[model samples]
Target: MTALDPFTDALDCPLYVVTATAAGERAGCLVGFASQCSIRPARFIVWLSKANRTYRVAARADRLAVHLLGHDQDHLARLFGGATGDMTDKFTRTAWHPGPGGVPVLDEAPVWVVGRVQSRFDGGDHCGFLLAPEAAQHPGGDGVRLMFLKDGPDISPGHPAD
Candidate 1:
């Protein structure tokens, strides 16, 4: 693999905690690989690392909820990013409500969207989950400044090896 400095090249976009539930199991993780892919159909895509517990749950899920964190929501990021779901119940520690498709939605999030998985594409170590927006809600106004890399250091990867 080509060695590159992600710290220097990384763009600070809004961080999101994506959650998915399927077969009585639920998983959520902090995601950095996400973007709006299409305009006409308004499709969005979020990529999850193959090694992430969330990805395994997502594979069987019909829908996923993407929640945008505010500048002060670092705890949410840590819960989903720093710790592995295989060892702990992330949802039990956080305040959440049932979202579309019965997915867990973090109550502290400023904005969130529930989308149906339309397609999936494998990209090396991550799998791109293409979503079609089914419902969305933004509790905060448009003036809210989302958490980004410029706010602090790039910390989404959560692991030193990554």
Candidate 2:
């Protein structure tokens, strides 16, 4: 048997800023564990850390927005990935508007998708939110976004989202 990290370590994946709103509160965090799991019905899944505030808010949220980070958007990545939302209102510093079901949509993101959570699964240290795509936008060219292990940019693990 082989440890998972040995295989996962070499995989390069895109980072996303997942946002959710519920009970008059908005929360978002940078996520690396997400993928499109189905094609016929077009389903996606994003795994949120159990320790983050985003997960807490998403627990009650019906919709979530996933933002695609561009190569030049490392600042947004840092803002969502490093700083803890417990202290700062990340919305005040960034440009965004309330989207479907009050989900916060980052205005700077060139590409984004809004999905309704179809199901939730407990994935040990994380909770997987299965999303059913409702809306999406592809407004830019192939500008490389941040990739784990590929860029390996200096970023803190993450802060809470709710």
**What TM-scores do the predictions have?**
0.89, 0.91
Candidate 2 weakest lDDT stretch, 10 residues: 143-152
Candidate 2: stretches off by over 4 Å: 140-149, 159-162
| Deviation in Å, model 1, residue 147 alpha carbon | 0.9
Alpha-carbon lDDT of model 1? 0.85
Candidate 2: count the clashes.
4
RMSD each, Å:
2.5, 2.7
Model 1 spans > 4 angstroms off: 1-10, 152-161
What would the per-residue lDDT of candidate 2 be over residues 1-162, giving only the tens digit for each residue? 358978887888988899999999888988889999999899999999988888999999999999878767878888888876776688988999988888999999878899999999999889999999988878657654544536646787565333
lDDT of 2: 0.85
